[model samples]
Target: MIIITKNAKKYFNYLLNKKKIGTQIYLFINNPGTQFAECGISYYNNKQFSNDNIRIKYDNLFIYINKNHIIYFKNSKIDVIKNELELQLILKVPNAKKKIIKKNKILKNKIINVLNNIINPQLKQHNGYVFLIDITTNKDIILEFKGNCNGCSMSNITLKEIIEKKIKKLFPEINNVLDFRYYKKK
Candidate 1:
């Protein structure tokens, strides 16, 4: 559920009455359910208008939010803060930073998730990153290295000792892990 505080309602009224804008505003979220989630407010242009947009009325104005975005807005509160000379809109969405995972996720997605959430952090320390490229019929995992690891002489050792071991350990079905730039399949 979303709550628009009294002060926030007043600010919305001010925006319509004093600013002479339309009676509609759009609530948006970018990269929802991730560590980098962000909430924003935007005005819809004529071309962007659609009757399908779900809206909630707040006396003087209406907030249009996509139905799918409601998940991130659960337990969300919209408020306003009055500073020295400015009124700032505050959006507190507690669930926005939580990662959403489905039970029936594919093997590729599962592997990518582990690489992104686990292995990439350690690689980032050395100014490098690795990502899955392909999974062969033989269950061989192909990975691409970037940044510092791309041309480094130690990449082969790193792949054998660190990346390969980790991938195989996490997903035991995986046969071999090969670096894309270094390993060319015949």
Candidate 2:
């Protein structure tokens, strides 16, 4: 239930008419590890639509949002504020703060359990182990490889093809499994 305030709706319609563009609008949570989750709007050209997204028609505009983010987006209200010279769109998301903290705890524990039970055991055979450094807001796993895995030639392949696949199979929310060693070498 995303509510576009009257002022914001009028402004949005004006911008669309003035530009004469036929692109759809996408509202999503951009969690780039900046300590706060931001509401981001994108002008989508339909080139990168996903089946996991929820499509909504509001007035003369179409909004696409990820299904996973719907919980935080519920009852969100968008309003246009004009201060002397510039106009800004302000989103009032009441439940987002609470949900963010709760979800992270749940996701982190689940990832840690998977790493201990499944992924680490396999790598242990090679006299290597991976430590979970952090989980990004985008659900990407950031791991630090230790022992033989730290500088192994097959680390990249192992992280992507094997570790990532296993984690993703268990938790669909998990994105990329990033090894810190690879980036440090680059």
Candidate 3:
């Protein structure tokens, strides 16, 4: 979501319309957290910079703002203060920062395709199904082993040696695999 202040709207529109060969503008809104408050307007051309909680990709020439940022600026008004020396976004709704998971659709579909075709087919003989629970940037693939494989004694070995190895071999990008099958608690 683009939060354009009344004062900055004109300039922002200009930037969006008259972007040069290699220039991109990104606005970052800080979330309310225990540690600190930090936000800035980032200017990029052709490089990627990532901080602790944010990442900017200049090649795309687009700012993929997070949900938290949007929520933070939802009730805020943007204005140019003090003869254009400073730009400010005033928050009308306090405590509006909400954290939410943002999923990459293309990557997710790619993972699901691989799982359905490769993993599930292989496990069909055991009446097992490989359900992908989640995928992380760290390349950890979380899966739930269902059917006969769920409570099997050798499930751990199957997951670690067989399933994990197969998945890693197929998708070299994955770093680790975790099985999240539900078992009776002792």
Q: Please estimate how well model 2 matches the true structure, expressed as its whole-model Cα lDDT.
A: 0.80
In candidate 2, how many clashes are counted?
0
Compared with the true structure, what per-residue lDDT tens digits does model 3 show for residues 1-186?
Answer: 234455565554456666655555555655543235455555555355444334433333354344446545444444445545654433343324444344554566777898798778878888987788877768788888888878788778888898789888877888878876542221
lDDT of 2 by residue, 1-186 (tens): 989988988877776676535667777786622347777776665557888887888877778888777777879898999999989888777656543456787888888898899989999999999988888877888898898898899988988898999889998988788887554574
1 or 3: which has the higher TM-score? 1
Worst 10 residues of 1 by lDDT: 16-25
Point out the higher-scoring one by lDDT: 1 or 3.
1
lDDT of each: 0.81, 0.80, 0.61
Off by over 4 Å in 2: 32-35, 100-186
**Native-to-model Cα distance after best TM-score fit, residue 107 in candidate 3, in Å:** 2.5
Clashing pairs in 2: none
Question: How large an RMSD does model 1 have?
Answer: 11.0
List candidate 1 segments past 4 Å from native: 18-23, 45-47, 101-186
Worst 10 residues of 3 by lDDT: 52-61
lDDT of 1 by residue, 112-166 (tens): 9998998889889989989888888788888999988787888898889988888
Backbone collision count in every prediction? Answer: 0, 0, 0
- TM-score of model number 3: 0.46
lDDT of 1 at 140: 86
